[model samples]
Target: MAEPRNCSECNDSLYGQQFILKEELPHCIKCYETLYCDNCIACKQLIGCASKDVLFKNQHWHGKCFLCTRCNQSLVDQPFATRDDLLLCSACYCDEFSAKCHACLRVITPGSKKMEHKGFSWHENCFTCKLCQETIGTRSFVQKEANNYCLICYEKTFALQCFHCMKPIISGGVNYRDQPWHKECFVCSKCKQQLAGRRFTSRDDLAYCFDCFCNLFSKKCAYCTTPINGLGGSKYISFNEVQWHKECFNCKKCCVSLVGRGFLTCNNDIFCPDCGKGI
Candidate 1:
């Protein structure tokens, strides 16, 4: 007669009753479940024979307990991701941890091209010029007022135009008379001398250096015979189609002051009324 089977742990008789084989050793159902069944990682409960067991990374979990840490959705046979060792569903993972494009404000998934600038990220196709609407892939760009633009579009849209050359002034330009101009283009119209960072004058909407303007346009003082440029707020006297300095406008014979007083002209010389009789 064959030997009778018995439970290995409890030593219970296993004659004509359901038993479990653990490592080729016969064990009672209660003993096998209590001694050898896997404990669920999620709920810390034992997984029995009638219960569905889920396995991941050598950790066991009950089917109902296997869920995403963030959304609490079941991760059974669905794509999932792990962040900081926490289980997460694909959608929840992207929403919670993925990089968002700065331009389009969309998710920048893994394995896709991305660009980053000033702590902001962008999808490759979405990073484009705001004005031209063209992709700026690994190319030079400008950011102004929270908008991105390519070099060409930035210059055309925001750069100052030189009043003299009529070209775009990208950087380091001069401003004169509320007009913009390139440094090299801001030159005297008469002598072609550079006028930037120097005293200059304008006539008929044209720029001229101080020397050139005084020599060409300033009127000569009748008494002093010197150019009266009216610079430094100096006052001058104008009469009989001639200009004179305030101190030089005097009678020729008596040397009396003639400013705001009646004067007489003798052979292109100014004399007071009393001095005119002697002359």
Candidate 2:
């Protein structure tokens, strides 16, 4: 068989040009000459082209092209501009109906406008709820602290108070700063000393500064007026302000000058284990 002719446009030898082969083939059917293939343009795959045209600028393209790549829309009777090899139709190129958010100054669609003043448009809720960093929507927005805020933030920011120390939260009160405190924290108020672990609170709901309560009520040993050192002492007494060693306070029950083990206290008086059981 005779060798087929080469494509007039690409000049590549015709081997599988007659069949579908590797790419879509475009040919001058009248002269039986190959013109171009699918790979000639990138946009052709996205929106199919009806007919090809060679322009005076040496660019080849389909005559009836639709869809601008930049804005991803059908380009029907619309003016277009090119930037960075992508075509932007006139609507997207001019930013038609685009407006800046009044609060954030972010460029958003004009349809989102809620209020307008002095050539600026604002989202309605954002205009009222200005306090604290929050995205304000229309329904729950209100004015607070001389600024706008959402309903949830206003409650947490103002109403709640610390139960233990009675200190008002300055920041992050709702989630982080919580109510209620250790008894020791209130007792140590006068001395301003924060107790390590042990705590107590008065039944009256009055906050006692740490110093006055600990000094007045803590039990201690009679002899030393110091707190009982160990947990399981048999002898104990209310010495200065807190519970203390009773044997250290001069073991009165034995009357034999008791030594070694401490005595325990109940109510206001000291009692040895036998005497305490008899009573």
Candidate 3:
């Protein structure tokens, strides 16, 4: 029988040595690997059939060696990133590049609910009303004094309904008798003039200016037949619902002013000291 053939590259006997047949020529394991094995990018080792190989982005890696550099998680056959030769799994990739949430101060993970406005961000579950502590989610919100609030809590805390206009007063307003009013809404009910910071009177919750009150509600002077303008709150005398200003009061018979002198009323007329004695 003919002698067993030898490996062409290693010169080892092929019948017992580990080798490969290339072009019907027996090549030893050392030479076969140099020609057939691929270099693994992850571990920087030559990969053969015995090694579980993974191909990605025109590069080869040993399956067990492909892992996220930050998390150290295996990324074999999974979505991953390789930037500047650093491998990263999807989650780690997103954490490395995503924006931080303003509420929690953490990275907003991919595929997670997020809310953003005015270049600020927050996780949906982290966004909440500062007053009620309720989750605001994607619904309407209002920012007040550096705090976030939902519409309901914002209204409940800051909405001031004007008693006159029946509308919400958002800024500076007048408050009297425990009722709130817009600056423009706090006006004289009779003249419709703005009365903010002005002296005014209220009746049945209706506000009026001093002049308007005198014109509409004051009593008439018995002599002048014009409004006394003080109603019942001045130096005056009254008899049978008839009133007179101190200066207007006089003895009807002598025509002498009776402001500080003795006087008497007869029927509907007044008499001074000398005039009364004659009567």
Candidate 4:
């Protein structure tokens, strides 16, 4: 017959009885629990043969003690996360540590898509245009104040319209007469020449080049038959529904200046007082 076995710790008889092998040594159930059972990492209680044992990273815990430290929910056979040596279920881990979406102010769970802008974060679905209420995925976007906008929505809502073409002026525009204009659209009304970075004038709300303005609108001198430029505060003489340059306002017979003094007009000709007596 085989030799009768005995408990390793207490030397008790193990004949025809159940026993536990620890380090290849046979022990009774009571001795095995007292001498070789693992203590629970969570509850600090021994995990005996009668109780289910859970082991993680070489640490042991009773089945009842193997739960999320935060929510106290069972982590057995479930996804879990560890933070600062504390066990947590996936839900509790996400709630306690995941980043929050900037738009909806809700937690953004791990393994989900997210968007980051500036210094804030958002869930993929929550990152949407403020005006159109549509998702703005990987496409281009714009941010205004505290709102996000799709490129189309941003242009429609905020871009200025060109004064001439009436189209959206996305960039590099001119502000004239309290109206916005595209650089290419701000041209002389009469000649169609580009007036940006060049001298131009407005007449009756129409923009014109200097030459066009002088020929189309400036007063003509009576004697010289030339346009009398009045831009930049230049002085000119006006009388009898006609205008003249100060140098051109001289007597026709004696060639003496008739400016700021008594003068006579004979058949659209100007004469000084002394020359007019003889004329």
The digit string of per-residue lDDT tens for model 3 on 157-229 reads 8888998778877667899789998999888989999888777897877889877777788887787767787
**Model 4 agreement with the true structure over 48-128: per-residue lDDT tens digits:** 999999999999999988999988988999999999999999999988999999978899999899999998999998999
- Every model's TM-score: 0.54, 0.31, 0.47, 0.55
lDDT of 2 by residue, 1-279 (tens): 454456544555666655222243433332232323332243443222334542323443444444577666755456666656665676675464356566766556534546654565666555655456665654554454446556666656664445655654333332212354443333444455554343533324443343445455555565566545444546664443544464564444654333444555565455566555655
Q: Any runs in candidate 1 off by more than 4 Å, and if so which? A: 1-4, 15-18, 160-279
TM-score of 3: 0.47
lDDT per model vs. reference? 0.88, 0.49, 0.81, 0.88
lDDT against true structure, model 4:
0.88
Distance (Å) between predicted and true CA of 268, model 3? 64
Distance (Å) between predicted and true CA of 74, model 1?
1.0
- Model 4: weakest 10-residue lDDT segment is 1-10
| Location of the lowest summed lDDT over 10 successive residues in candidate 2 | 30-39
The candidate maximizing TM-score is 4
RMSD over all Cα atoms, model 3: 17.0
Question: How far does residue 82 in candidate 3 sit from its true spot (Å)?
Answer: 4.1
Report how far residue 88 has shifted in candidate 4, in Å: 1.4
